[model samples]
Target: MKMTTHQPEHYNNLQKLCRICGERRNKGRPYHSQTFETQIKEVFGVDISDDRTDVHPKYLCFNCQSQISEPSNKVKEIIPVEWKGHDDDDDCLVCDIKAVVRPESFAVPEKPAPKRRKSEIKITVVKKEAAMKLKELNEHIVCSICSGYIVDATTVTECLHSFCKSCLVKHLQTRQTCPQCKILIHETAPMQYIGTDTKLQDVINKLVPGLMESEIKRRNDFYANRGLSVPLNGNSSRPITPNTQDSEPAKFPPDDGRTWFHTNDLKMSLCIEPVKKELSIPQMPMKFIRCSMKLKVEHLTKYIKQKTLISDEIELTCNKKTLANDVTLENVWLETWKRKEAPMTLFYNKKK
Candidate 1:
């Protein structure tokens, strides 16, 4: 009989067929025919049906009955996920979601014994003395760049390696890679990736008492004698303008005597810099220009094309990541390039 949704569950569950196979008898009474198994054994005085026959039927094992049987084996719906706009008529969608199963665990489980009683833990408090030797973390206390005790500790964001702030910054001006791991700090200005490790510095200072104070005093004396503003995290506290340069001015070549154009409008101005040893065809007529923050990458491409008589497409990049033509320069400056320093630097190359 075909089952329907409206069928009474009790009526559907009841079966009065063969005890062995739960099927109807097909042959003559217990002797000449059978519905499923047809084996028969005759005892001393009487005839006996073999196992699985109508007379001597064997029930299914527990596992087989649970798996092969119907409703009793169905997983109960303990958690119903509401599909706001789902249209698919599949009933098994609930099983696909991760960590959403609520399987009934009927098997007995062995529990782990607690190491300490909750009452004992809550009531007890012990005084413990802890001491750490400097030699244990000797390398951690020393600056990887200087190979000395860390002074004004700073950490590289990419590799999470700590070093002397001055050593890391000065190293970055020449090379933009981590000294310890050689990971790229940044494509443009690697100095920005360096962060002051205040906690690490504090730990170092405590480990070697008076080191931080002595360093700060020595730094103050040196700067005072030189008649310069005190330094801030290895950099000059005085804000650098276009006309002036950092302490190490002789290292970088001059920007062709280019200076920031004085303007009332607070729009962003950038230095269209070609990388070192790059072709001079890319060198624009004006190295500096005051433009609206809303300038798109396509505008920059067109501008570059006008300056250089070339048919090849130009590609703009910040931190070595290509810029989409539609993205505004301000978005790139704020989100991608992240060159907060005045005269934001952007690198470009011909799309090969």
Candidate 2:
């Protein structure tokens, strides 16, 4: 007979097993003809045609295909299976397809958290607008006398001008007018017209941070430069206790009632010369009186103004020389009145 031997069943039915899950099925079954490259392209939306010639056609069942296709939740679960013949290949078709398709599904090891410190320094940034406002406000607090930030600030009541206390004291030693406004602060005693403006000082302290401490240092430096002790209360009028052991005792007693003289270390007995009718002083000559040698010529001028009710538009002279307001009694005594007597004579003339 023509039909003799039956072909082998193995040759008749070509059965294939899944390379990934090892699922076996006959040729006509659902996934028997499925390939790793085709399945990757269909399921994972990955095209592996360029690398398909280099890779053998790997078979996969429906379940294994779905596992790799929808690996969003199973990325960590799916261990990369190595190819049987390729020892160097750690990645399987499922993992390769997943990496090509949804790379974000892989679990990247989380970075370790940064170490925290116990103390964290915080920086404060001031805005340009706020800084500008502070700068603008600072101009008002500056002293007109020294053109510096006011320290131990004093104000002229007549013109309402502010200055540092030392600056104003030094200014008034020569001038009776305000440094800023040129207004007459006092005809005779400008120092008496000025008072401590604590309100302004407090305002400055609030406006300028660290200003009070710096001002204290400046005042201390001033005292140090003059070889004088810094006053505890910062009042110039406050008497500094002298070192009695180092200083010689005063020849005369302290003039406790006198407000003009600072100390009575040296004394001079003055004789008032008889004034002419045209002169702006007393018509009759006055008696001799002891005075502090530290007194300025201006102090004598003020005294004459009080006693004789003469106008300030008058000048004092000794030996035909007009006495400067800054001239001290000791200097005048040494220069002009030394050879006269224990009681020296002084003359006054009207200012032309």
Candidate 3:
């Protein structure tokens, strides 16, 4: 942002108009000696006319001049030049040799522009387990007795050991003992599918695309390796059910204490009948029929051999008939009913 008077020759004009002498001059062509005095005054900033005339009178003037801080001997040995107009061919006004003035502005040092270092941006990621409620299994893990497999099975005992459905059934069929710990178990004891009606099943269903196939198979394989029966590919056991008696009709608790059955109106089916008309063409012997049918028929013929004693050719009347007439259709009936099954309870409450 700094501006420089890089034109040193022009700077001489500025330096000549120092705050010392209070008069304005035309700065036209002055005498050589007077011009040298002016140049010296401009450089030294003071009038110096009293002594020492031969140090090239141009360089000797001094009046209120500041001490030359620069070593005088070190002045660059370049020849002084004559003053000239903007013409390039003119010679120097002093030495009269083809003159060149080294611009002081060129000597002014330049500073390098500042740089911006790029910084790395880091992203931090923290892994946290999703918050989820534990869904109760509709079935037990494996048979408690032999640590064997069960299919579509869930088992829970007072000891909290679960068993596979088939395995538990088999164990109950035999000695009714926990396969794992040899504890006595009862058939009536609470032994329904344990985990169900929980959000975890929905999460599992969402996470695993083929839930019943892949996830269930994986779990079954794990149980099977532990001597447990795996559920079959087709059917699995239902979720938790409260125990109930088969002879007693199942009762549903009421809406506002009384349950009611609702019915839905059935959708009706539609049937369409077709009509026909005909017109004869003046240019041709053929007749065309315009009918409600979406298709156009050029001609229709039927051949029938009736009970004729002898062969004979017969012609039928040319009246058009519609086959869709006199049609009978019955209204379809559809019904759906809800049948309540007795709830099966996990805790039959009978001690083994």
Evaluate all candidate structures by whole-model CA lDDT and list the values in order: 0.56, 0.58, 0.31
Top candidate when judged by TM-score against the true structure:
1
In candidate 2, position 79 carries an lDDT of 35
Q: Which lDDT value does model 2 have at 14?
A: 20
lDDT of 3 at 324: 22
> With candidate 1 superimposed using the best TM-score fit, by how many Å does residue 122's alpha carbon deviate from the native?
9.0
Model 1, 266: alpha-carbon shift in Å? 21
Q: Of the candidates numbered 1 and 2, which has the greater TM-score value?
A: 1
lDDT of 2 by residue, 1-352 (tens): 1221222322221223344433342234454224556656554454545433123234455565666667565533433222221124333332243432234433344999887675765668987753357667656798876777888678888878888877987787567788887888866445557778899999888888898777656666666556555543332322224653313222122234633434413356787653465643464346566677678988887777667776656677877778899998767776666445667777766677
Candidate 2's TM-score:
0.32
RMSD of each: 27.2, 18.5, 28.2
Model 2 score (lDDT)? 0.58
TM accuracy, model 1: 0.33
- Say which candidate scores most in lDDT: 2
Cα error of candidate 2 at position 171, Å: 1.2
Deviation from native of the Cα of residue 172 in model 2, angstroms: 1.4
lDDT of 3 at 126: 100
